[model samples]
Target: MTMVENVRNGLLIGAGPRGEEGREPWFLDPREILRTVRLRWITVLLPVLLLLGLAAAWTHLNPPQYAASTQILIDPRGLQVVKDGLTPPDQASDASLLLVDSQLRVLTSDDVLGRVVDRFDLAQDPEFQGRETLLGALKGLVARLTGRTEPPADPRLAALRILRDRTGARRLERSFVLELGVTSEDRDKAARLARGVAETYLARDAATRSDTTRRAGEAIEGRLAELRDALRKAEDKAQGFRARHNLVGTRAQLVSEQQLTQLSDQLGAARAKALEAGARLRQIEGVLAGGPSDSVNEIVQNPTITALRGQLAGVERLRADAEETLGRRHPSYQAALVQEKAVRGTIQAEIRRIAAASRNDYQAALASARTLADTLERRKADALKVGDDFVQLRELERQVEASRAVYEAFLVRARELQEQQRLDTSASRIISPASPPEKRLGPPTPVVFAAALVAGLGLGLVGSLGLELLAGRVRSRRRLEGHLGRSGLDALPRAPRGVAGAGAFRASFGTARGDGSYEVALARLRHRLAAAAPGQRPLVVLVTAADDRTGKSVLARALALSAASDRERVILVDTDPKGLVTRDLGAAAPRDLPATLRERGTLGEALITLASGLQVLPRPSDLPRDLAGRLADALLRSDADLVVVDLGLVGGNVVTERLIADERIPVLLLAVSARRGRLAAVDRALKAIGAGRRPRIVVTDVGARD
Candidate 1:
């Protein structure tokens, strides 16, 4: 009682008036994600365990499977007894991959699998038969609901399907080997099936080659018979033509060609002789016509003609002399004329005889030439007949040669086909034979369990993240800051152990707890406030929430207690009409706040100090319209260094509007365990209030979703 009275008497002492300060927009911190998972570990781990359990149950109910494997060599080049140039060579290229793939297809073809099924009699086996299963039961239930009945799977089809499902083929990397595996409930059956598929493939391949060879041989034989007949006919026709034309020489020439050559030479000689004769005849004709002549006679040699001309000239000279010396009728002139005429007549007679002999020679030469030409013409006619005979002969010989060549080629092909058929082998061969397996072929129990565990963990993490996304709640300080568009001033833990109660500020600050976590957080809040409004003493921080139940009143009290503990005077004002703060502080409600404000009543009378030395102002029933200015003045003049105004929840109400209207007054927005809907309400309120900037937000009770 004495200590309580002493405390009551002590007036509020202001150590130093503290002010608040400044601030990006929000950013994500990965540590917050880890914190979220750590806090909600139960929510994340439950699904994981359930998934793992289901996986284990499923594996246990299914029968263990055994696999048997056999290896086959896929040689790109097939084994052939004869290598012909007609067949393209197998080269190492990307095309080899196509060959390997084709082999794989053949391995799984219906022919191979059908043979295996028939050999094993798998259709009668219970394993391949349709039976009740979890999936089958579900399908049946669905079918019944849909009013449809499904027929049973065919035995042969089911067997084929099972074989295909259980078998697998994979090519060995960088090699020509292929691995074929078959899985079955019975180990021996798996081995037998694998071996059977390989044997059937080889048999089918060999049979295909043999059948192809046989067909080719039959075709070759038929073509060879036709070619032989054609060759015989061509040879017979050629022989007949040769017999008729007598073109017996193997060389492409005829005997008539030689005769033509001899006749042609004879005709050339005759023609030359005739040309010489005609020239002589033309000289004779020219002399007879008295034009000019150049001919020689046997009687008048070249020297004789020259002598005669000399004599005639001498006589003419004498006549001219006599004519000059004597009169017109002189005897010497008359004798000269007679002598010249006689000389001229003698020369003419000789020339005329030569002309007659030339004519006889030309006629004889012409007759001989005509006879030679007629003989040549008769020989040409015979040669033309021979050439006509060779035409059919040459065509028949060409046909015979072509037919023989074709017959030879076919004969060679037919022999090669026979050789190929005799030595045919499959492109692939079994290299490793399958044997019954001793252990199960599927993944080991431990490995399967580990895989299931990993998958479960992944699914659980995805599910937890999905739920968080769906709820769209701010469960961490980082998220809160992001939603508010600015970093938060402080964060409070939800129900930390050793904290006395939800709103027990005194219990939170007790020394017995060795500086409570909540108390430390409050100290940080005070530090933030001082930094936000630096150099300004007696800062008024309006504390409000987006909605009721955000624990704003408790936060306000905590802040006040923290400020006072720092040796600074702090005032807590409750302006909520709900009376949350008033009931919590155990204070009497103030009456007629509007009248008190109009008259400028004493603020000291309205103040009540708590047990923790935290001063509180009860909310008034009636507040004046100039509440922000009045409150600001009161807080500024008061002995308190900091004023924490608790306006329960910010709304469009006139009271909240008045408090947030003042720009000088720093607002502290208390966000507690807020969902997307609550933040949406806060955003609306802020917009309606027309506040250009966001207030300093403080998140409390993190991870407590509402």
Candidate 2:
């Protein structure tokens, strides 16, 4: 078999399945960023060195600042002299934090710092009399321009401002310890200022406490006087009310109530006496009528009544004896009878007297009871009349008691405040006094330089990344392939300077050997093509670029020569209306391609053959209206094993668009690796060709690989 037939059978293969486009797994690729930094190391390093130098100079030229710090414990509840104070002490954690924060503010307040300034006599010192700042100078300049005069600054105020600017106060985290720090150029001044601030803060706090106590004591004293007057008035009113109502008695009861109670008792006693006397009188009367007088307890107990009864009994016995012994009228019996009769008469008279006495007693008792009842009734009326007055008097007395209570409370508070005014105490005390620092503030020189170096390197790295993004060039093969979503793409090195335009094309696949980079790249491309689509006869390859002057025509001619050198039937067609490839290959024809097509000429009549046995079909100067149709017809009529068409500057014409749209025809997109926007241009070309089409990319003018 011939070499052409061998190549056709061995090299031509059907296209394999394409890989699926993958999403970037990571948001940012550190390796790619590092590669970009490495590529532009000079851009990154310049800023780093510059910053390092600047830091070194700054550390050397600037004077060191000395700082001194004093620590004070803020305890609002400490050294309390009284139970109730002007400011209540807070014990909650959040409240304590807020209290400490407030103390920190107080430590830096003008009240404390102003005293500090006076104690140190900083108003006259040059250190405290600082120079005008830039902003102040600008203000002064503006005032002068506007013909306005500013008042002279007070030296004390200026010193206070300077002290406030140079000093700082902060509370330790999660604690009540406040640290007051002062910075100055002079070490001794720094220490003095720190100590002065602490001392002044303590003095101010003590003075505030003492003043608060004094003011509170004064206020309590005034309130106590008012309360005393009110108490006096309340007592006077209560006494006057008591006098008017006659509601007088012991502490417990009023006189009207006591009198009414005594009257009621007497009335009961009188009524009982009257009932007893009436019972005795009735008993005596019964004895006089018919019943036994002995049954009357009063009469029975009377000595005279008892003796009479005995005499009458003796006489009656004598009379009975006389009546029985003397039948007729005898002198002795008559005398006994007369005696008995006299005794009986005496007993009766005694009984009658007793009964009269009982009746008198009954009448006296009844009268007494009636008088007592009348007196009690009058007492009750007086008591009822006094009830309303008593209630009013009690209300007045309650007011007096309330006033007295208030007066007493104020008196106690006043006494406590009076005692507190004598005591000198503060809420915070200095735990650590300020001392002159051994070293300066801020970091050491070596540390500063190291930090500067790191900062400059970071800045430079950011700058380099920015420049890389702005340039937008393809630097890595993996990145190019990843961006295009295909593999097996080729990158060709820049041609040798010794070889010109046509010579560079000829050297790509001709027998004349030159640089190995371009030739080796071409060979790799051919192998990739053979692997890309195997068992495919008469393969159509379209060579194009995003923009003009990207060596697409040269690449197309090289591809054709490569296949022709392999003894394969190859044809190179120029579809560019400019006929750039035709002029470059020096292919001249007797007739233009469109005119020949219009006349129905044979493909050979318009074709130009090179010494390498590669046929060329050049484009006309003016493109035909149906360029895509004509190109399709020409491609159909061709009998070559491999047809290479140079569709110059993709998306420039409808013919190129139609050719790219055809899936059967594979596209070879030429890209300049060094050109900005090259990737974006290639992406635009791919999108125009449509998403289903996967074009083989060739990155040209690449530098030497590592």
Q: What is the TM-score of each candidate against the true structure?
A: 0.54, 0.56
Clashes of each: 7, 8
* Candidate 2 local lDDT, 537-601, one digit each (tens): 66778888776343676677767766776667888888875667767666467577777777666
Number of the top lDDT candidate: 2
Q: Which residue pairs show collisions in model 2?
A: 12-535, 13-533, 13-534, 13-535, 14-533, 14-534, 14-535, 15-533
Give the root-mean-square deviation of each candidate in angstroms.
Answer: 15.2, 11.7
lDDT of 1: 0.70
Candidate 1, residues 1-706, lDDT tens digits: the string is 1221233211211112212211121223455556546655776788778877877886877678999999999877775457672224576668888888888989988889988888889899988765578888998999999989788778988989888988999888988788999998899989999999988988888888788888988899889888989889888888877887678666355667776788889889888988987886776677678765445333345465567678889988888888888844988889888998988787777677767887788788888889889998999888787776777777777888889999999999998888778775556789999999999967887887788778777776666666666655566555655665554235665534423243554444432322444555565556656777887677778877776343676677667666776656778887877766666656464545555566677577677765556677887756655665777677667777888887856663567667776677765565454332255655665666565756666667754221
Top candidate by TM-score: 2
Worst 10 residues of 2 by lDDT: 9-18
| Candidate 1 colliding pairs | 20-529, 20-532, 20-533, 21-531, 21-532, 21-533, 22-532
